[model samples]
Structures are given as structure tokens and as C-alpha cells.
Target: TGVSKGAMLSHKNVVSNVLQASGAYSPTLDDGAEFVVTALPLYHIFALTVNCLLFLHKGSKNLLITNPRDIPAFVGELRKYPFTVLTG
Candidate 1:
């Protein structure tokens, strides 16, 4: 949402804390879409809020990459999947 840590945290809590049951109803991940992640850690509030929570809620596969310095590799990874959304 916002650049400041406070704004980030605020949005994270409000956006990520979704209610979903854990059972066979567990949704599928990455049905078919464009989701690219470059150096975004799941632990971070930004990624956790937009990437982890939203994807899981929508049942999308999360291609977690800790290191995104290598642009070529990142592009390659991006090319491999059909993601609907690419987050930072």
C-alpha cells in the first residue's frame, strides 16, 4: 500500500488476516496465471500481505525466490509460469 513501515504494517494486518477453513476444501494453487516474485521474502509484511495471503486465498502456486539479484534467472522463472499478478 504505502511506502512507510507503519503504512505497510497497517495494510498487512488488515489485508492478510483472512478467514479460511483448513480441510479438503483447501484451495488449489496456480490454476493458470502470471505471478512473478523478485527477491520478495515471504516473512516481510509487504509480500506476506499481497503475495502469500492473496495467492493462498485464491489458490495460486507461490514461487518463492529468496535471491532475485540475477535478473536473467528471475526472467527465466517468470517465463516458466503463467502468473496473473507479479508482486515486488
Candidate 2:
């Protein structure tokens, strides 16, 4: 996976990607009303920008999964919440 060196992104770059993704996905989220299940580690750009930042920007709840490898526990946790969006 060591394919390239780390690249820096400005605040505008991050926000712009989030906005573009939101438009493309058209997530039907309500402020503080929807739940988002995020199985990927937040350290990753995809999870950091989309699942955590973008959803929070729209005021949706974020359910962080510390260990997605535990399938049973993951499924159990998923069932516990009426998640509106799921990203891994």
C-alpha cells in the first residue's frame, strides 16, 4: 500500500471534496436526525472527510466502529441503530 508519499490538502480542498461527494450521493440527512455508521478508521482520508466531517457538517450522528473485523459485534451494533448511511 506504500504507493506514494503523503500529500497535503488545504481546508478548501477538503470542504470542496465533501461538497462534491454530498451532491453526488444526495444523502437524505436531517440535522441531528439521521445516523451514519462508519466502519472505516477515521485516520483514513475517506472516513475522515466523508463519514465523519461531511455527516457532522450536516448535523447527522456518527457511529464509529472501532473494529469492523468482529463481524458479529459489528452486525449487532448496526442493528442497534437505525443507520441512515453506512461507509466502510
Per-residue C-alpha lDDT of model 2 across residues 1-76, encoded as one tens digit per residue: 7778799999999999988877866656566777899999998999999898888877888899999999999999
Candidate 2 Cα errors over 4 Å, as ranges:
none
TM accuracy, model 2? 0.83
TM-score of each: 0.56, 0.83
Question: Model 1 over residues 1-88: C-alpha lDDT tens digits?
Answer: 8775534456545553543322222353343343545358777756765577666665666787667887898888878877656665
User: Highest lDDT: which candidate?
Assistant: 2
Model 2 clash pairs are none
Runs off by more than 4 Å, candidate 1: 1-38
